[model samples]
Target: MKNTPSTQGRAYSRRDFLKLSGLTALSIGGMTVLTACGPSTETKDSGATDAKSDTASSFGEGGKLRVGMEVAYPPYNWQTSEATDDTIPVEGLDGAYADGIDIFVAKKVAAAFGLEAVAVKLAWSGLIEALNAGQIDCIIAGMTPTDERKQSIDFSDPYFIGHYGLLVKKDSPYASATSFADFAGASVLGQKDTLLDTVIDEIDGVNHMTPVDSVPAQLSHVNQGACDAITYNVENRGGLLAANPDLVAIQFDGSYQLFPDEVSCNVGLKKGQDDVLKKVNDAIAAMGADDSTWETIIARQPA
Candidate 1:
């Protein structure tokens, strides 16, 4: 992967995906269950004392930028058994590597701090706790900096900004929807504990199904006719539509639009890491105009 210079261009819309052969998940409470990334088979909580206190910041040992992610969300991040110049090794999963836009941004941020990038695989719910406990230095997963999250950690400027949409099977009635109003009475599904889930309320008369833990799970439910559609980032349409030829995205850019016009994907850091935050922000600022680049990244997702 190459380092794209930050120009004054806009970032792409949001991202999330994947299905692990041996999937794992953990239950969390409140706003935590709804964050952007999904659960992991791995536990990152080590019960360590708080690494952050007194407004001070510290980096990991050996000049490593220990960034944490679910390592199961594709287009954003996902695990692979094979290594590529585009991947970073998963800290605990031997022979496994993580690849996606998040990994790309993590490397640039690490470079800005003169450190090597290392991927720490963690449950989506455990990222913040892990960061605060010194288990990891920062989180580069595809997380939105929701007001609820700001209470626990500070975030850098957005690395990716995306729009939300719905995915339905090609033969489904919702596939013909051109406006939000067209989906009345249709059942919809979204990832648990994510904006994807909450957005279901935006549709009038729509049957909002219980939230699932991952995009892949949402996909499964849709395929099985358990739901009419699944919420997703419109920017991911290319890869997903290509991979699941049976699906179509209901992306609106005109009259009927995504409830949230733009979803931001930002970096989460433990509070008080002002210096590190600034450095990471600077790296993000240098990553100017990712509109097309991100599409390229999406185009390359493993099928």
Candidate 2:
């Protein structure tokens, strides 16, 4: 139930997800300028199991815990120029900052470990690699703990649980869809390299469009009629609706669950960091079972 910094407006563009090959140092006072990966559909093998470093009770150098996330995603994480007491400055981004539920939890974990919390913006695909390569200490980017990913890295317990829903233009014929079967031939879209895109195949006979690179791109495709619909997390319903009034959510009946419950959300980390993983899990558990705090953060996300 705490307020954090947020975007001033909801207008979005493709530039929001920038891909750069420049190096981003995780060590404090080490990086003068930083560049990060952009969104892509490809899912590269994490190979995290083979990327172990010396085991230490603490993480990062210079008393800093570098946390990685896709700052462009709201509710989970987003970039903003406004700095409040609750916001963490995005490393290497002069005036910009990061704020959301992910950041909230990141700060909590950093505090528990006695380190300065720093937000490192990264591409969706880069999060796992960054953690393994030591470019980041942890990933607090609303990542799910899939068996495939677990093979490469470790994960904290679930933080925010949300249902999967589709977003369609408010006036579209498919706006009234009440079940997955209602959109047999519909052209559905999803963010590249995400569970959202993976679930689109469940709709029988549906035309699954090539996944876009980012959520902003997904919103653009649905808003501009480039696609009939896009998959999204239901927890972001309020913010998404407020930002794009022309869109409507199709919450299908209980015939099938579009998203699996076990993979709701978690903090991802590198393999062999058993101590770090335990500390991260402990930090998450300390946040408790009440969803109210997490929901409030979601509700207050930038529209």
Candidate 3:
């Protein structure tokens, strides 16, 4: 694991999911800043036929690194209507582009593999299936690789290390909370199929509501008083607060306990693809070696 550049917000890690799962080309001289659809849940088919049909000799034009993401996770990844010096036009989707830390990371991996980077928009629940079916090459969306996820697909070295936190209305009673226990008996929102959903159980008496698809939806629930708070990556706290100033991010300190495997995010790859894995890991290691570069990329995002 590498040390992630610190932002104005506190970063905490999400506990491991036993599962796995951005962009832009704002040039920092040699880099570009840039920027999913899918089922609501993982299906058994995994589109294996599609993966077989799309097999290529190696990772750009011959076989661009088809990366899948939800494009709804801001600060990590998000969709934009226009392509700019800071965004990449999504493949197979018109009038849409992407930007954020994930995009920067994807481009680095693609460049390392000597391939082109193509953004594939897939539903968060469907990302794994897309990868298994070959709808995309890999998943770089702030996904944490756990033992369970490793059984289905391989994960490269972690590119981003983060922790989970909650987003609540600034004026809400929970705003000054110092621990998950503070939200006890309170309604909480999280994305479907994500570790955040399961982590809510740690809140003791929390009212874990049904999960939703996007951050916007989760935040909406919080804003509307449908829920008192929502779980998210601590790295995204700054972004969340920036996007919704009315909301405050609560990250626990000594009062919170995170297991060892809980909070690291890594690159996800198809099973038995060590060749591609090495390339991505190498890229990640190289990127980690230069903290300034990572900080520059992080600074580019609004959050």
TM-score of 2: 0.77
Model 3 misplaced stretches (Cα beyond 4 Å): 1-63, 81-86, 251-262, 288-291
lDDT of 3 by residue, 76-118 (tens): 7777665776666677667777776688888888888777777
State the C-alpha lDDT per candidate: 0.69, 0.66, 0.63
lDDT per residue as tens, model 2, 1-303: 111112222111112111000011111111100112222212233432234555232466878888888777766787767787667878767777787878888888898888878887777877887777777888888776666677888876665554466889989989888877789889999887777787787678889999987877888888899999998866565566666779877754532224433235677887887888778767776765344455455545553
Predicted candidate 1 versus true structure: per-residue lDDT over 229-291, tens digit per residue: 888865555556655668776655431225654566788998997888888888887865444
Candidate maximizing TM-score: 1
Measured against the true structure, the TM-scores of the candidates, in listed sequence, are 0.79, 0.77, 0.75
User: Best candidate per lDDT, number?
Assistant: 1
For candidate 1, the 10 contiguous residues with the lowest summed lDDT are 18-27
User: What's the true lDDT of residue 153 in model 2?
Assistant: 87
